[model samples]
Target chain A: MKSLSLKRLLVTSALLLWSLTSLASSQFTGPSRDANGNVVPTPKGEQCVEPTADMRANHMKYLLHKRDLTMYDGIRTKQHSIVACIDCHATPNEDGKIVRIHDDSNQHFCASCHAVASVKLDCFECHADRPVEAFSDADYDPVQQLDEALAHSDKPHALMNRKVQ
Target chain B: MSHLDQETDMKNTAKSSAPNKIDQYRRRFLGGSVAAVAGVAIAPGVFLQTVNAKPADQEVTANNRWGLLIDTTKCASGCSDCVSACNKEHGLREIHGPETDAQWIRKVTLKNKSTGHTINLPMMCQHCEKPPCVDVCPTGASFRRVDGIVLVDKHICIGCRYCMMACPYKARSFIHETLTDQLPHAPRGKGTVESCTLCVHKVDRGDGNTACAEACSHGAILFGDLNDRSSEISRRLATTGGRELRAELGLNLGVRYQGL
Candidate 1:
């Protein structure tokens, strides 16, 4: 009878764990969508450097790695750059105005994902979200162009004036 | 066999069966990888630059000693153009007045005690070679860059006013209040001591002139590489010997004042 009761307790605990996991899974949804049921943002490039699954799982880790590399080592590869991420992700809406990440209403790319995950984004507290220069239609990859120009050109400041297509 | 040798052997085998479709794909992959490795190996300079944190063009070296030559004779009294320009550049416009406001550069009028003559000059973080501020800082946040530009790296500054106390010029200022709408280039925060960076951002961007020098209508401020003898400031300094404030200290200030 004792052995039977112990087995029943084990079964009850398993059921409880299953219910909790189901409840947690149900609460924790994927990326949030807009009112029209479409994903809020459509980033400009064909796709990111990494696959969607990898990016979803490890985007912050990639960003942090890039940040350390750029900050300490100055290894500014075009891929995995926060600047590039902002260039692609921080697009203007139908009204032609770009929403900042600080806004309470989730509109900005970083803010949208962060708000869903309940992660506090403090990068914008010191760093600017928007790109300094307004990119034209011709300038698809300004960061890469700038990097190349900086590499070749002796006058780094002059490159700022030159329009790269 | 070594891993690289084994990999090369595999590639050679893959290349031998080049006519086969799957082997052709494998050979192509190996060839592309080999080419990529060769490319990295062939361009050592480019690879080194790619690995470096500082951009290739933005190299701050000991050879280029950046400094400012202030022509006090040309600096007109009551004209705060240089001060205003610096304030505007760094977005130090949040006017709490001189008592609390962060002053990156300031216009000072110095009077000769017995000579009955006064000279106007723009005083700032002197960018000393042997800065006392740097020596006193426990966190080593107050530092002189490679190009003789003194800056407080706010990231490591623990709000300890030792640097401010050590600074002979009283150039450093502690942010007393929370800041908002800071300029993108100059990131200033409260509880951090900041001083003139000599516009290191502008220097890094290869902007030859500082805001103060550019803004000075009277041509009082001259900014250039002091180490380069051919530089305009160096030529001027050579012609007219400049004075360092508290020359007794032997700090070897980057900022020099003529007709002081």
Candidate 2:
């Protein structure tokens, strides 16, 4: 009887330990890896302009303020500019192609976290998702270039034609 | 003392202070000339290098009133290079017919019925001093910048098209279809009113000229500060003169036309 009770205690503790370990590990699992278990591309910058925690909390505030300054006041300083953010964060993949922010794969830096957080990103609907260098040629016609890019993309028309709400 | 002696003494005192006053005036004149000469010598180099570029950190102020002088004689009747350049620069595409498509600038040919004389001109947003669009906008989306450039704040524009009805030039266009892959400098989304920004991005970049102005092969367009007396546009307007379209409306348009 004593042996059986000791065995039951050990089993209970083992189960509890296993469950606690699983929960802790899941907490650490970030959006760094995609559903296919591929490592997501990181930002090109060595470090963000602000500390990571601070940026995560107050990036929208900075963007909103800077946008107003740039739009109305014509203050085009690079600090906290959306163009600077896209140039650093939206990096090319192994295939040497940068993904659009609204891509369903959710591999793009902004989209990955946004997808997980269930936040709808409307900025990319009007703004360029990639740097100018990502385009094939400097003087290429934008309409033709976009058409060719869409043709090569897997979900061509559907992605480009998605209505903005 | 005798009266004559007293008067002479007073004259002597006046004579004594006269040279000192002259010397003070001379010093002031010399200092002013030196500063003026320095400004003249150094200004051209700085102006030529960075033509009308405001500092990136500084806010655009009312000190600079940007204006454009278009020579109608230089603009060809069939030529649409300016329009094409504007479209390319702003990433404007023709997804629909002329009725629905966005056009920032269009060529209008005017003919005198009695004289049989014809004139070709490129017409765009006048960028009025007191913009009717700004006044009629219920959402405060249509606004004029401090530097005299009129712009539609797309974020606040609710696609009401009130500005379109208010504008005398028919300058504003409302986007009806969904758009993607817009240029970084120019952000256009559906359900927003947009018009000729006068290349505000380039203006902000200190490029000194709009894409349309740069692409004009005949040099019909002269863009410069209307406030600056020495600017080519202002000097030419002062000498040769330019007329505002619909002058009776009294909008005081930034864009002026010559040979119309």
What i-RMS does every model get? 16.4, 19.2
What is the C-alpha local distance difference test score of candidate 1? 0.69
CA displacement after TM-score superposition, residue B127 of candidate 1 (Å): 0.7
Candidate 1, residues B1-260, lDDT tens digits: the string is: 43235436545532322244355346556765885687588776443222112363333445567899988899998898777678767767433457677888888888989997998888899999999999999986777765688777676789989998999999999998776545556667888999888877677656778988999999999998887767888888898889888989999999998886
What shift in Å separates residue B32 of candidate 2 from its native position after superposition?
25
For each model in turn, which proportion of the native inter-chain contacts is also found? 0.03, 0.47
Candidate with top TM-score is 2
Listed per candidate, the RMSD to the true structure in angstroms reads 16.2, 19.5
- Sliding window of 10 residues with minimal summed lDDT for model 1 chain A: A134-143
Clashing pairs in 2: none
Winning model by lDDT: 2
lDDT of 1 at B127: 94
Superposed model 1: Cα runs more than 4 Å off: A1-88, A133-165, B1-58
Q: Residue-wise lDDT of candidate 2 within A1-165, one digit each (tens)?
A: 878757645544454454355345545676345433443566888999876644654466568767777887799988889988988888887677788887777778777666654557788877888876775542235456547667787874533642221
